[model samples]
Target: MQRHSARPLAALATIGTLVLTGCGTESANAGAEAASSTGAGRTIHAQKFMRLTQVHDETGMTLLEGPTFGKDGGLFVVDVTAPEGEPKVMRVNVGKKTLRAVHTDGRGTYTSAQFSPYDGRLYLSDFSHGEIVSLAPGGGDKRTFFSGEVDGAQMNPDDIAFDEAGNLYVSDTRGLSENEAHGRVVRISRDGTKATVLAKDLAAPNGISFDLNDRGLWFSELTEDRISYLRLDGEGKVTSRHTAIRVDGGIAQTDSIAVDADGNLYQGLHGRPAMAVYDRHGERLATVELPSRTEGLESATNVAITPGGTKAYMTVSGPDGGYLYTFDALAEGIRQSNGG
Candidate 1:
């Protein structure tokens, strides 16, 4: 890990969950509105917007992630550990600070969500079930969108991205292998009649986003501790790929990511309530941190920004509980910021 400061840091997320860490406090600022200054950057802190979930009275843990916004400006989020029968896909009334589950037949482990540009329906990546499911904007009409046995094996779909044509791009994490190069980026045609593995044999492809003009995609491989950009051809096939950003090993894994109008990437870190910003060309911009690393609020797993604006929100969870934080984005928000 490249530490700009020599100061020691501390905790959230533990040894026994999807996040694999523990947290306790609830204060942290993640991103800020883009500044015109070209001098040394300052730390950006996040403000706690709401307490999304309480600590599991029994498990002492909760994982809050997958923050995405709908067309109507409704904020949607998911709980990775919410039991089978509970409402896992929830919509947060940002104005009222209340939450309601839109998708509630609940039987799958939904990790990430994004609304399809073509149909305006919300699409979620069911990690445990190895499927991609879609539901109506109001949470009705749940439908199994994709269930392909790619390479003759079930996919562990982690994050999702949709192109202008509505084709789905998914990150198949390969079931948590540290060094195994079995991960893949799968592309499911918009018609739901075909599935193609765009890229394979990856370390662990997690967060993903489409590039401007639908030319390609940028994604993070948590196991390798780096982010790469995959340039796609006219048909959304990878024609060339290159690493954009590479960071030293850190205890915290890279979770979901977002992109801004300028193409800057806001990469969320799993173990802390913070975010790392990188320019479109891969220059490290800044690290948005909590003003005070309050206990139990360290899991800044995923983030979402308002379309075409700088307003943003981050989803967090830990030993203390789950929360949503708001902050200014580094640049004007784009569609990529509201997706998986």
Candidate 2:
């Protein structure tokens, strides 16, 4: 692993279930099945915007998650070094479109990493270690925040996010069996004092995010091929659950998601070559064409959006190399309410 300054850090499917069940699948209808509307959202098509930037994962077995922006304006990413490769965190300057090593702790195989608006630190998920680790910027301060041994079953930490009040949430795609790999979302405190399971029994939970107002928690079930939502409580506990998007096809599990300022949701598809955009009302807004076939583009896993709602970033796990790609975002538009 490439160590840097102050380095410390860090789906299931059937036919429908089989396709979208786990991470990747060998489905004949994968492409066609992913090209339509799901859930309550209206399906819309998007024009090619901009191919802003592309990054190459120089080392590591797989670039698992991220492109998560930092307060200092750079992005944090994790490389899951498989089969005895030391995991690493890389910093990318979005403005300069350059990459640099931030931390190299040989910290097992890490799947994803995210910046917490509350703590100003980075939370990283180690899939092999089954734990969520925290790393100080530039690899300064580091420690394990939460371990992923839920109900005595091993967990594959996939994604993490935070709510308005700074509460941390993580997705654990446990595995296959009903109780075995059903998947669940866990919540951690800003101070790392409390760790709680917010929701359980989800099928291969992957990317997670909160609504614009932070009133609800949204998660993706890769195996079930559905995006689910849960109503949060005063104490940050998830109360009610519902489906946001349920695709009817081979398999269309989502890997990552981003939300616009206008309350729209954008999801990155794992197998197919595109991203799904949803309006606030759970209406399918747009399906943007991603660079899917060019090697790793087919496994476009994670996504991040600028706070200003202008541009979006996606990680392309290409064959020869993994890359970070940028796209122009259409913040939000209002068609004239003709008959209102």
Candidate 3:
């Protein structure tokens, strides 16, 4: 009787093992892949280059954005929260690590600082006033280039980029979260004569970049947590569009973007203290983390690679203050990376 019971128990154990092994192979493989992909990137720590915490308004917060190199090789940045009469557009000296205000004014929350390659003048996106403004190389002759409504709606211009033809592109992000479907990608002719709507009803398109060889236009959608690629025609009209990359930020949101000479993308995060690196094929390569990630440096917002070099700088802000961090890039920087 004892031998009979033992034999039956052993057979039952074998049956249970077979059932588990025969369970959905696809499900098992997916689980294994997800497990291996957790924390799936190389870790690269960055060094803090500049401290920007001391400069803030009554809100006691400072956001350093738009780390792009000017024609003079200095990095131009903007402070979106600086009060009127304060330095809203500033430049960074890489060697000396110094800051200088190039432009300032009221009712204009300049979020991006970019120098036009054609005219050799500086352009800024006024997020507060929904206007695209320009400044001379010496910060003089400030002018509003784009203002008021477009297609019977107010324009909430966020980030600005220039194409190879000197045509300007603007991301009008005003209605993603509210589902008002008012986001648009507007293009201004190189001659500044016509303003055409390239794409509209986007999901809060924020950071935009033009690819070399006119391959495609890369733009980040904040609400959907993804980067979109638009193939435009010679007239700045979209021929085809596709999703370049999708991000799983959890609490974080995608901000500005920069592209390298090899077409790799550096995406900034709003709540996370790290930048995600992706290859041209949308495969993630690494995550650039701040040395002070847990020490109050949480907002890693944008990155700019040194033109013709791999040196990269990121704009960061947190409860402690705003900061500039530096690291080595995965590839050489392209012209779009300059003030992207």
Please, what is the TM-score per model?
Answer: 0.86, 0.75, 0.85
Cα deviation at 281, candidate 2, in Å, is 2.1
* Top candidate, metric TM-score: 1
lDDT of 3 at 142: 91
Span of ten consecutive residues with least summed lDDT in model 1: 6-15
Off by over 4 Å in 1: 1-41, 57-60, 175-179
Overall local distance difference test of candidate 1: 0.74
- How do the residues 1-340 of candidate 1 rate in per-residue lDDT, one tens digit apiece? 1111211011111112332221223334433436536532446777778887765433345667678888778999987666544567889989888888776553566778988888989898877668899989878788999886987978888889999889999988874534568888999998777899888888778889986567889888877778888999989888999888885426666767788888878887766677887888777777666656376565577889888877789887666667887777777777888747
- Point out the higher-scoring one by TM-score: 1 or 2: 1
Q: What TM-score does candidate 2 reach?
A: 0.75
Give the per-residue lDDT of model 2 (tens digit) for 228-333: 8889978887679888776542544566666666767777676654667777666776665543334444455666666554556666553434565555554631
Off by over 4 Å in 2: 1-61, 82-87, 151-154, 177-181, 248-251, 291-296, 332-340
Query: Which regions in candidate 3 have their CA more than 4 angstroms from the true location?
Result: 1-36, 53-55, 176-179
lDDT of 3 by residue, 1-340 (tens): 0111121111211222222232001110111112135644676667767775443544345667877787788888877666666777888889887888787765676678777778878888876566778888868799877777777777677778898767788877777436556788888776666777888878878788887666678888777789889998877789998888998778777777888888888888766878887887888877777643247655677888998988888888765667787778877888788545
Q: Could you tell me the C-alpha RMSD of candidate 1 in Å? A: 5.6
